[model samples]
Target: MRILLTSALAMTLAAMAWHAQAADPERGRSLAGQCRTCHGLNGIAKIPIAPHLAGENRIYIETQLKAFRSGKRQHEMMSVIAKDLSDEEISHLAAWYESIEITATMPE
Candidate 1:
């Protein structure tokens, strides 16, 4: 009974930690202000040079951002920008872009 109780407690703590680490969209939105110059506030690209970020997969964004931050991926601007980002900041940015709704329309 004691062992079972300890296991349950451990599981509960693990679940709480997981939830705590979940990305926050509100924080992401605030942090994403700087990203607006290129990606736009709504995650749409503002110019031809930038790619649209709206509704992109969170994992893809996180991976790319991490790569840029670590210098594994090279980008003139992105490398500079990503260098200052923390892991949490990267997660938030991913969440922000992933939260946007996007749809593709088929041209008839």
Candidate 2:
């Protein structure tokens, strides 16, 4: 029927839009070049003070980045860096870091 066809069309459009907006880890990896001095290419911190970002939850990373961008969380360096990031960029960075797989082991 016409109604069924219209509903299917609407659902297809919405799905395409969602897919277009999805985060891209490859783009995030490219963007992460800026973060490499402190955080390594793999999201592990190169500096003692910088926390490791590898395997961190995507939402948690997004939240912290947004907070830094908004000045709610104060980090002298992070504030300066995050201020220039767009929402898309934040999502990409989070995606890149979150995509990394890490395993933990207890010392025998």
Candidate 3:
């Protein structure tokens, strides 16, 4: 009985962790609407002030988001935007942007 209980608890924790790792691109797409203004079309924030987000790595995006949220990465606007985003929201957006079908075109 004790072993069974422990196994069950561990499995539950593992499941929760897995879900936490799950990033929903669909949800990310919805959340990204707010980012569209600055990031611009196809993740190319044609504006000089904004950084492009399309085609970035998933882990990289997550790390940056976490940093912005934690106030570790101080930027002119990123901190302000990330300050209010929930962990789940950040993860979702990361997934969406990371999976974007379009890549930004760099200027020569």
Candidate 4:
């Protein structure tokens, strides 16, 4: 009985941890629609003020997101936006963003 109880508790804890890590790539793609406004729908930043997301390294993206979420980096808009995102959501967004093809036009 004790063994069974221990197994059940372990399973329950694992499930909860996994729930924190849950993410959906398709949902991430849809979520990125909001990002399209400033960054462009194709992940291209129209102006120099913005950085492009497409084809960026996933680890780099995650690092930056963590910075924003943790207040290690200070950016008013980004912090507020990132604070609510779970690590899983960030990963999903990173995967989707990384998969986009990168291209930029030469400036005049």
Candidate 5:
């Protein structure tokens, strides 16, 4: 019984740690203010050069951001901006953008 209890405690602690490391949308929203010039707060692109970010897959966004930060993906502006972001910040930003809902319609 003691071993079972210890295992349960360990699992509980691991779950808590996982929750603590989870992405935070509110923090992402706050951090995303700097991105508003090109990518609107709603994740829609404000300028022709920027792609819309709203509803993009979190994994995809995270991958791209990391690539930019690592210099594997080269975009002068994005690389500069991503260079300062921590992994957690990238996760949060991806979460926030992923949370937005977007619909596409066929253009006539």
Candidate 6:
């Protein structure tokens, strides 16, 4: 039982490390060229129709993209675009957008 638990933990860790390695923010930046029309290169939305992605939670981004890819979520543009994205590509995009920082200030 102990051995089985240890093995499971090791496998989980390995999977996490592999996922971390698969996401490349630089590659995502390059891929973002296609997204720049709606989502700015910096992850801000170019149009009001799009939502800002900068500093978004990584898991949230991944979840939404996966949903779009799987047809669980429907958006006219996102559904089509996400259909072609591999899991690694989604991870990279999530990593890149999550890496950005945004600040908001309250009126004084």
lDDT of 6 at 105: 100
lDDT of 2 at 15: 76
Tens-digit per-residue lDDT, 1-108, candidate 5: 999999999999997578446988778899889888899988999999999999998879999999999999999899999999998999889888988999889999
Compared with the true structure, the alpha-carbon lDDT of candidate 5 equals 0.91
* TM-score computed on alpha carbons, candidate 3: 0.71
Cα RMSD for candidates in order: 4.7, 5.2, 5.7, 7.7, 5.3, 2.0
Give one digit per residue, the lDDT tens place, for model 2 in 1-108: 999999999999997577446989889999999999999989999999999999998879999999999999999999999999998999999899999998999899
Model 6 TM-score, 2 decimals: 0.84
1 against 5, candidate with superior TM-score: 1
Displacement of residue 38 (Cα, Å) in model 2 is: 0.6
Candidate 3 lDDT (Cα, whole model)? 0.83
Residue ranges of candidate 2 with Cα displaced over 4 Å: 1-21
Pairs of residues clashing in candidate 5: none
TM agreement with the true structure for every prediction: 0.79, 0.80, 0.71, 0.68, 0.78, 0.84
Query: Which residue pairs in model 1 clash with each other?
Result: none
Each prediction's total of clashing residue pairs, residues at least 3 apart in sequence or on different chains, is 0, 0, 0, 0, 0, 0
Question: Model 1 over residues 1-108: C-alpha lDDT tens digits?
Answer: 999999999999997577447888778899999899999989999989999999998778989999999999999999999999998898888888999999889999
Better of 2 and 3 by TM-score: 2
Displacement of the residue 77 alpha carbon in candidate 3, Å: 1.3
List residue ranges in candidate 4 displaced over 4 A: 1-24, 103-108
Positional deviation of residue 76's Cα in model 2 after best superposition, in angstroms: 0.6
Candidates, ranked, TM-score: 6, 2, 1, 5, 3, 4
- Model 5 misplaced stretches (Cα beyond 4 Å): 1-21, 105-108
Candidate 3 C-alpha lDDT tens digits along 1-103: 9999999999999986885568898898888887888995357786788888888877788899889889899997889889999988988888887887763
lDDT of 4 by residue, 17-91 (tens): 674356455666877776787666667876678799888876687789899999999887789888988888887
Q: In candidate 1, which residue ranges exceed 4 Å CA deviation?
A: 1-21
Query: Please, what are the lDDT tens digits per residue for candidate 6 over residues 1-108?
Result: 999999999999999888877888888888888889999999999999999999998779999999999999999999999999999899999989998989999999
